[model samples]
Target: MRRALLAITGLAAGTTAMVVLKGSPGAAPVAQDLPAERPTVVPAPAGPTPSGGDTAGTPQPADSTASPRPGRTATRAPTSRPSATTRAPSAPRTTTKPPPAPTTRTVTGPVVENEYGNVQVQITLSGTRIVDVVALELPEETAQSDQRSEQVDGRYSGSSGLVVQRQSADVDTVSGATATSTSYKRSLQAAIDRAN
Candidate 1:
């Protein structure tokens, strides 16, 4: 029983030593990345030929021993013929797509710090004409105290109402806010441009 136990222990130790020497735990084989072995093609051994590899230099006699057989015939030489040439049709033709329409609109205003707050303009355009115009976020205090009122007459230069004339214009600006009024007027002009 003692000998049998010794033998089993020795076998386990040997197996563990082999595994460590082979580096099998998460270690790749040394020759795994090398290119695969392939068969080498060797050219056949050739002997020297007569006539110096050229049959045209020296013409052999008809009845000479070096001549070919009587029945077999040599192949004919290759020939070259005229190739066909095609010409495209001559015509003034063009196929092009039209440019896309502009879909974005923008409005500009001034930066004015009034007694109430900052001032900015609001403009609304419909197509090429000014459809709507308004002051952006007016102060509640100014609206109550100003009491601005005006009557403006508009006339078209031509038969179409493309142009207009303001007969009477009344405007009310903040106590120290002329810039705010200018910004509002700029917004109105932007709206008019949208209308045209």
Candidate 2:
């Protein structure tokens, strides 16, 4: 694509130069930006040599090794032509798509402290759906508190747990574990909020 554009722009500039500097045969080349050297000598027009590139003012040779078409004669055609193997490129056709972002992630809520102990919750989510909940910490200060924490953890945290089944912090509180249950729900809500 780039080479084609350069070729086209080069030819346009060469045409403009020939028209503008018609009589000044020795003036600078008006062909497009060739490097220190041009790709090849393009054929000159039939009317007369452009003086932009073809050896200035001199009559160009009708016979040459570059292109020796039998009928070509007398015209100031350039000596070199594009090689046979060189072909114009076509635009690409494939479409590209980027991979999708990960949908499953785990989020941990801040540790919430209450009179009984500190409670922290973690939740795994698949897109907007809650997949599981886990109790990272709970009150282990006393035997009764430990049993209550276990009761709360068992009721609320798992793949098929009540928390996932309810999909919210509004699970039924255990009868004797009100404080732990409330703390657990608070931590779970915070984790869910952070995940969203």
Candidate 3:
């Protein structure tokens, strides 16, 4: 096996060396010739050459009624015509929507008591829209409860409040703290009712 492997390695090295040396160094270099300049020759006009004027190959204005020169055909000028399919004039667009007029107000909710403790929330509104929801009180029966309440409140404080306000009291309860969510929503709904 070792001898076979050594033979394979030697074959690979020999193949690589042959490939590396395959290109011929004595190949002739390609010749790159510079482009030659050509003189510009404009064709003479069919009509009588203008005196002392260089109007060779210059375009002449079309004269449809004029007779064609000998051996040359007269070209007619193109006439403009209306399109076969005419588009109907577009109607002016109209909007009937009234502009939004937001009204800002702040209202506090009634305290809601659940199995954990009392929960109360204060809500800020702009017209019928709820702008912000703040917790006035939260359940904290024990030290652990207080810590859990703090963590839950921090997580849901802004985002959860916005959800409840926009979605109303029927929003989904927060995971791992259903009781807290229920109590908070109850209090928030009361506050929203007061604002309305």
Candidate 4:
């Protein structure tokens, strides 16, 4: 039969190479058969050691106070400890007075020509507060007078710059863009008469 099927496939490859060279019957113990011991070194004291002068290389407090010295690592002692009682020195602080300099200003107005064309406004201020009313020349000649001067410069220049900022340059006009709200309130009353 082909030499007995090649001798039963060489006896199942020599019994899987002798169970992979006879290894695992559990397997762990080999560091020179194991039992050495000597690592106890302790010595960490440093501060109050002048007592018996020759404590060799000083550092000995570890006889296992619940195991911490195998390479020395303890550190956490700062939970708020400063109260021996002498605290009477704190009264010198009254300085509080600095906030007045922003009267801001910026004017520009007088171009009022109109019939759907030259307006000009600017304003700004801040302290007498018109804050911001910018229309710097409006009616752009024709796309329906530039879409009715950008619909009264965006809905009556913010409600006529908050009514000429709380009624300052005397307010009114903006109804249906009444001639660009009376030439934007006569160029915001010549920039509120040059900001007073």
Candidate 5:
């Protein structure tokens, strides 16, 4: 029995030794006919020649994983992009204003006669404001022979500023013509009121 056990032990040791000698159990194995991990060197794709590009070109496969052919334009590569500062600028808002008022000028006489036909008056207006009043060209019947031709008569009884600014008008002498002068004064007042 010992002899048989010894024989079994010897056989097991011999098998282990054989495996080690074959470079598998104890040492790293040597791969037979194994391929190397070299990088794939595929070519670029072909395209139409641009205005100034070279004419010689080769076509490539459409699959993205396939390498591009030599002398081919790369369609998938990124070209140009815009910077952050070149967008359109914004504008400010604005407002407008209104127009001004109108101005006026002076107007003068349409000479008029009064009742009993002895006195006359003329008026001047400065834009609806009475500026002058005058008694002019009186009749001989209401005037005295001794009174000067240049003398003013019928008393300035209207707006003092308006009457004083006027050129004095001659007085007419119509005997018992006091009502005529009173009428003349009333007419002058009417003209001034109209202007106002």
Candidate 6:
């Protein structure tokens, strides 16, 4: 903004000076007749102009349109400005992703036994929330026990099961697997406690 302001001020000053100098008596001969449109012709600013500018045949500066009586003419060199400064590109920055999600891990509980058989629970956790549960061991001694165990596992274990949804062992027992369910809860609660 400052540079632009300075440039405008310089241009205005230069134009005013040129008009005063060119129109002043002794600079040129007075015209016997005036033209229709007095168009002001201004040159490239206080900047570089092409070399060999003045034609060898003409006495006046190339800017003048009239054939003026030959006299002394003066010229000054344009001022040069320093180019804008620039910095070299710096090394690429190293960016790192946030340490992976604290990672979900499975924690096993101490074995808990009941009349049915020994029960052990494994819970997969992320932070403090239970994400999944698995009954590592359940009674499979008899056909009835196997069926009952499956009922207990289906209701309380797996990713979308009661243990994970409730995020705790406080779940309703399966109809035919009371003892197995109770054992499962005890083991799951212990596993959760260890995780925390």
Q: Backbone collision count in every prediction?
A: 8, 2, 1, 4, 13, 0
Task: Please report, in order, the local distance difference test score of every candidate based on alpha carbons.
Answer: 0.43, 0.84, 0.70, 0.71, 0.50, 0.80
Cα lDDT tens digits for candidate 2, 173-195 = 99999999999999999998898
- TM-score-wise, the better of 4 and 6 is 6
TM-score for all models, in order of appearance: 0.27, 0.49, 0.43, 0.26, 0.29, 0.50
Please report the candidate that would top lDDT against the real structure: 2
In model 4, the number of clashes is 4
Model 4 sits at a Cα RMSD from the real structure of 20.3
Off by over 4 Å in 6: 1-100
Q: lDDT by residue for model 1 over 1-196, one digit each (tens)?
A: 9999999999999999998888887887785343223212224325443645764544443432333344433333456755566556689888887866634444434434556445444444434443333355443365532332111101111112222123111343434445445444544454444434
Query: Could you give candidate 4's per-residue lDDT for residues 1-196 as a string of tens digits?
Result: 9999999999989987876776567876454432223344566675777685787666666554455555544444458965889687999999988988888878888888867778888877777777677787898877877887787777545535554547565655556667887887778887887887
Off by over 4 Å in 2: 1-102
Cα error, residue 159 of model 3, in Å, equals 6.6
Tens digits of per-residue lDDT, candidate 3, 132-177, equal: 6678788889886676567556644564554444546566676767
Which candidate has the highest TM-score of all? Answer: 6
Lowest lDDT sum, 10 consecutive residues, model 4, at 31-40
What's model 1's TM-score? 0.27
Q: What alpha-carbon RMSD in Å does predicted model 1 have with respect to the real structure?
A: 22.9
Better of 3 and 4 by TM-score: 3
- Clash pairs, candidate 3, are 103-127
| Ranking of predictions according to TM-score | 6, 2, 3, 5, 1, 4
